[model samples]
Target: MEPHVWPLYGLRITTPRLELRLPDLDTLSDLAAVAAAGVHDEDEMPFSVPWTDGTPGERGRSTFQHLLGTVAAWTPGAWTLSLAVRSEGEVVGRQDVGANDFAVTREAVTGSWLGQTYQGRGIGTEMRAAVLHLAFEGLGARYVTSAAMTDNARSLRVSEKLGYHPDGLEVLSVRGEARTFRRLRLDRAGWEAHRTVPVELHGLEPTLALFGL
Candidate 1:
């Protein structure tokens, strides 16, 4: 973890009960195992990409490869931070924050998943809050966006609690079928208004350039 070449590995976002950081190989393996154990019910898919619709082994492999792909494809103008979310000192999930031409737009998008065993504990909200803090406070972002399936009440509820307003709607093909998603957006004022979690960002200075800040 010297982060000599990829300084993003040095960034850390901490909530009162969770810590989010880019995973190293070993930590990445643990995160993949969490995915293998399952993040959602077998009958339903929350992601628009249908990435979780696979065998347990395939799901794990996909998680591993996707995280690596983000790192390999990164640029200062467009980058994704796939952070392993840890609670009680163990990896429990993953949180992703990304932007396209962030220096010009000053906007970012967030996504996340938690192991089935770790759900319903408010970990999701805390982790997302940590990233929002990084975007608005640490990086001077003006807006953060998210989207959840229309039927994903849990995700929509989280967005509402975080002071996000419905921005629009879109339909996409998932699993060979059309699915609708509710788009949510939060501006700096909204984020500051609903900020409840105490977040601490560490080592972000070294990685600011990586985010095109």
Candidate 2:
């Protein structure tokens, strides 16, 4: 898949144990399969959107379409960069960095999910560190934000490990029930202070304009 027409496809961000890139068609299928295999316990809903509550096939198809939709709906003023997270050359999950009016606001938000089999190994922290590097270093972003359910200790731990601080809380209707979520934020100073992972960016230069850089 040549990226001559879509340079974002060429952008890549790598950490010690993971590689993050926009998936081509073939890799997208593998990523969709990872979603089909499952990300969290059925009784638990970590995401506000219940896209994963569907059947196995539905989960996979939804994952596939969501990534495609990100590409289709992208604009200079608002965009979602959904990168497929690969470890040991296999797709393990996805890491997303998104923003609106990034050039002026200089803020980006992140969201992600890892396969159930890949959790609890610190991969979550490492993958996020990789994207924070892109957001702050590669794209000159001043702040990055994330949110997770208040009970989602794993996700909150990951954010804390990466230097994010509590911003606020939100009450949302998840699956028709009230859910409490914690908002977190990290500025450039905090990101620089907590930098530990050695991340490498490739092909980001060409995609900078698309991010309104």
Candidate 3:
């Protein structure tokens, strides 16, 4: 818990209603359970990776393994901050903020998933605002980017509320079909303009170098 080796474990991003942090083992297990319970309608795949298209047990295991893999695979040039999203003291989902060559590009990407039960409560926007705060305000990032399946209206709406503009579209093969994704981008100006939620960054100073800042 002290994060003596990987200082990133100490970083925290908080909004008025949510806390996002690297999960300890017990917290990670709870997060895995959230995934097992489901993040989207079974009939629709919101993610490009189709990572949730398996048995509940498999989904849980994959969630656990993917977070571990992010930690194991991290480097200064490329890294993912896979944080568990907790609201009212309960694990509700995961939020990831990551980048490659951040020192040079000053850009990052965001991704997330909330348990099916937790969606549509505005938690998604607040949770994302927390990380956008960390990226632009805490880390001096110039821009942030994200993408969602074109049909994912909720996600696109969240992005729009956060001041992200349509960057373009990309077609990707998903679930054996060609799916289009609406790419979104936000710059420092846009992030500052749409900042609604109050976000606090904790224990990030020690992890700046790890982000290549």
Give the candidate number with the greatest lDDT.
Answer: 2
63-171: candidate 1 lDDT, tens digit per residue: 9999999999999998999999999999999999999999999999999999999999999999999999999999999999999999999999999999999999999
Give the higher-lDDT candidate: 2 or 3: 2
Off by over 4 Å in 2: none
Error of 1 at 77 (Å): 0.9
Model 1 clash pairs are none
Residue 29 of model 2: what lDDT? 98
Whole-model alpha-carbon lDDT for candidate 1: 0.94
Model 3 lDDT at residue 62: 99
lDDT of 2 by residue, 128-168 (tens): 99999999999999999999999999999999989999999
Candidate 1: list runs displaced more than 4 Å: none
Clashing pairs in 3: none
lDDT of each structure? 0.94, 0.95, 0.94
- Order by lDDT, highest first: 2, 3, 1
lDDT tens digits, residues 1-213, model 3?
777788988888888799999999999999999999998988999999999999999999999999999999999999999999999999999999999999999999999999999998999999999999999999899999999999999999999999999999999999999999999999999999999999999999999889887
Model 3 stretches astray by more than 4 angstroms: none
